[model samples]
Target: MIQAPGKLADATVPHIITELPGPKARAQIEFDKQWTSPSVPRAYPVVPVRGEGCTIEDIDGNLLLDFNAGIAVTSTGHCHPDVVRRIQDQAAQLIHYSADFYLPIYAETCAELARIAPMTEKCRVFLSNSGTEAVEGAIKLARFATKRPYLVAFLGAFHGRTYGSVSLTASKAKYHAGFGPMLPGIFHAPFGHVADLKWFDEVLFDRLVPADEVAAIIVEPIQGEGGYIVPEDGFMQGLRKICDKNGILLIADEVQAGAGRTGKMWSIQNWDVEPDILVTAKGIASGMPLSAFVARDSLMTKWGPGAHGTTYGGNPLACAASLETIKLLEGGLMDNARVRGEELMAGLRAVQAKFPSVIKDVRGIGLMIGVEFDSHERAAAVEWGCFQRGVLVLEAGHTVIRVSPPLVITEDEVVIGLKLFGEAVAEAATKV
Candidate 1:
């Protein structure tokens, strides 16, 4: 093994060996199938045994540059030293407390999170185990704070898969199928339609639910599962204005787009809009299961004491991991995301220009990116092509090829991943 360096490395690129999901990986899959749930193996083959920087190694000893970042969860890369050390040190000391008891690390994490989130001075936080749980808490807080029934979300928005969040998520039907009677008073509207502003002012605001009774409007600054759809200019600001006009809270769901993934602390910052409640998870703790709902103190005061609570909400190990993760993001790693993302996007745009038929559209702000295709089949073909070439990627929305690599992804690795993706696109185009 190469001796570890204290600072960042100069040259960073993937080194591939055996084919992806090779013999050892296939054997592992065969064993996993014996007990693992079927729902867990839906998309993407299983290999990933180890990872560092932007590359993941399969059980077969194949190294593949990770572009999905565990669905945008590992913004600081896999098992970052700081995060690993924190988790290790904290785990050795104390790991669980059921959240019923107070813990210093939990309180410290909350304090630091409030410092970075918008409106920190007046915000209070509630911790949770996963992204969906945080969304549920945010919704509940909004409803409780306003004592109102109506809530609004946009089409193609994904909050979470849980009941309340899934109801707010209007992206796909599969998440809501057979789950009868979602949270009532939840309404859907077209996002990015600025021309409809006056209509909301003169009509829909009251016609929909009488602005007085509307509680909040939840939106992702950049849509994740619905495609890396960035909102139009002033769209978020306009929403903030409407919420202000209607006395409704504006909730920003940043589970997949926040924490330097977009080259900023929060994706909403790009639009210069502040949310009353900000929901975040996924990359917060590197790989730990941690999510949080932060809201203004006054707004959070609506709940007495027992309004929300979870068994594994604020485990010390997760908080320690998160503390280290956030520190790394605020350091040089985020700057790397900015530089590497520009290079990756430019390369993808070049690919788009070459094959407009296969590559419908390439859009994203920073590391979170998407390459849309004319058809789902074409998209799937591109994915398979990349897989065959020993790279990993994912799909979103109807026909979008998602390309979100870890923030730690180096320029050379990105070029390699892009080359593989380009080859896949070219092959897919010929197939059609």
Candidate 2:
């Protein structure tokens, strides 16, 4: 029988008792290949059968330390007791409800979002099922409120996969390869550079779309898929200024960096720049599927009845999970992220020092960290090395491995991850 995750977050160390993805997992993978769509990207062969805290048990009976946090979605760690309990209680009370009608939990969730809004003015929230829908809603609200046709997004930013959100995404060409006739009036500027905002005004505006015609300027305060790029304070401040100057709304895509993952309630809080609208998801509900796009009350009021509605946007179970998740975050998890992040970053830097040529850079804020290698090949090798060692991780950007673990990650867990990471890097150096 497969083992179960430990009671504590750091209970499991890197232990590979059998071949990676041993017999049972290999069979599952074989069947998955036949039944599942080929488009889904499978990072590694580890197939999880059970999870708790910060660990997962693969189908093959190997206990794996989960540093990826299910792609940084499990904020309070896998199946956090409080979040799970909330979800279970809510499910027993009310399983599903349409937001078209009044729902007590839905209103409560919105009120909570308003309480923690990063905007300067009072804000209202629009709940959704995923980050893509939140992005779509944010852009739609910006356009409806401003009555403008143009949008400005960063070159390396990833909004979502929906037509509207993907049109603003410029991270990978492949995202747009088969799709065509992209939404009109969308433009991209070099991200994380203050000077690019100036170039956007001088060049893009002078030659292409007029600045005044733009409805919103969307950006990721910390680029996730492109890389864990933490732009300087001046960069985000510049975006805010540019948006204000053009009478355009600033939309902060905080899907991957917000919800206290960056040691703050919102990722943009780290830059001290308030956005007109904010989109967040990943870690908002601990592990449940939920997302929100919050806008200034003034802008949100422009929409009347029938402007927007959702069927399952505010699932009662998910809302319950979110409320408890935010409680955990506000209570002390954010501080844990800050302290543990410092230790992890320092350890990663030491690893970089050991293999300077292979490792390029180590950067992030709080628990949202990334280790960039010199090449994609090297990054893949190191990623596989980490997986084999039993500490889970995922690659981002072209040559970067993201180190985003759960906010519940403890000091001892950080040390364990570091030790395994360093050994993986050492092994990867020789081969790649």
Candidate 3:
């Protein structure tokens, strides 16, 4: 077993040493704004120079609590010791071994994935550089394996920004505004409403596409970017039955919700429903670029290798980091998510109680949570307020403040975050 990384977590964090965006940060932000793409949606400026565990030291010399976790990528927290050492060790040994050839580290990473797979039967692992690539690859695999022509996704799911994955994405109309004809034959189902699988058979199949021609039905176990909306148990169970009846592969896009973020190796495991293809990333490699789409070995054998491949999908350094990350998650972070999740939820509920007019709901499992505000303006205000106070956070959907901190965050840190968050909520509530 690989050793767990030093948590590096501090309880009394957000040690602000300067103004929100001090002189250095202001200049850098201006520089970045001039050079970087306009499409990047930076919530609030906290220019990070270095990070450790649950805290970030900004370029302006202010230390802020990191609740965003680099958009839920740093599962083992920032610069985890074990993950860093493994990555350093692997980089010295080998940096860019082409994925075209075999690598021991790659095999080890895949093996660990197989061991933790939600599938009951033997599974195969395919590595990719990011979550979008995983979804894209799985899309191709689902179509090829099923020999079907159509795919179905949920209304509020944010799959990715790429053509094919973005085609399946329906979180915002702007995503498809000019993208024109999204890959054809993809259907969208109202997410939380379709608890019974029959909705697909009756409404979608009857009026729109034929269910039999569908290749797969991809879903985020707990919707992430669109909002941290957790579907009811019956909804997930019904989804499985629908897929079974329609000969459609079930794809769980656990990109933002996996890697023990939801207290499970795969978020779908919470529903006790296994997907035909499980696409996961975000927190997989502690910060290194890595994602894997694990599927039944039987289904994967369909691909004749060259049919699909990537240049840096299984880079040795990423593999090493992933291996260490899995060990760290298994060691204790998974349970930590579960335990801390309850504490966080209870705390958030208290905030909601205090400002019922502002907060609509507090929902999610483990550390993957969303606090729905009555209006997007209020949500934005609260997000900015938290940022000003040096506690990092992000917004999702239209009116939700997402609280997805690293799993290693301690109870005291949770208390501090909630205290700051509550203050922000109270202020937002009072706003006209």
lDDT of 3 by residue, 91-167 (tens): 88999877788888888889899889999989989999988899999999999999999999998999998899999
Runs of candidate 1 with Cα error greater than 4 angstroms are: 1-19, 196-203
State, as a TM-score between 0 and 1, how close model 1 is to the true structure. 0.94
Note the residue pairs that clash in candidate 3.
none
lDDT of 1 by residue, 303-350 (tens): 887888889986798899889888888876677777888998999999
lDDT of 2 by residue, 212-296 (tens): 8889999999999888888976999988888888898999999999998889989999989999999989899987889999999
All candidates: CA RMSD (Å): 2.6, 2.6, 1.8
Total backbone clashes of model 1? 0
Superposed on all Cα atoms, model 2 deviates from the true structure by an RMSD in Å of: 2.6
TM-score for each model: 0.94, 0.97, 0.97
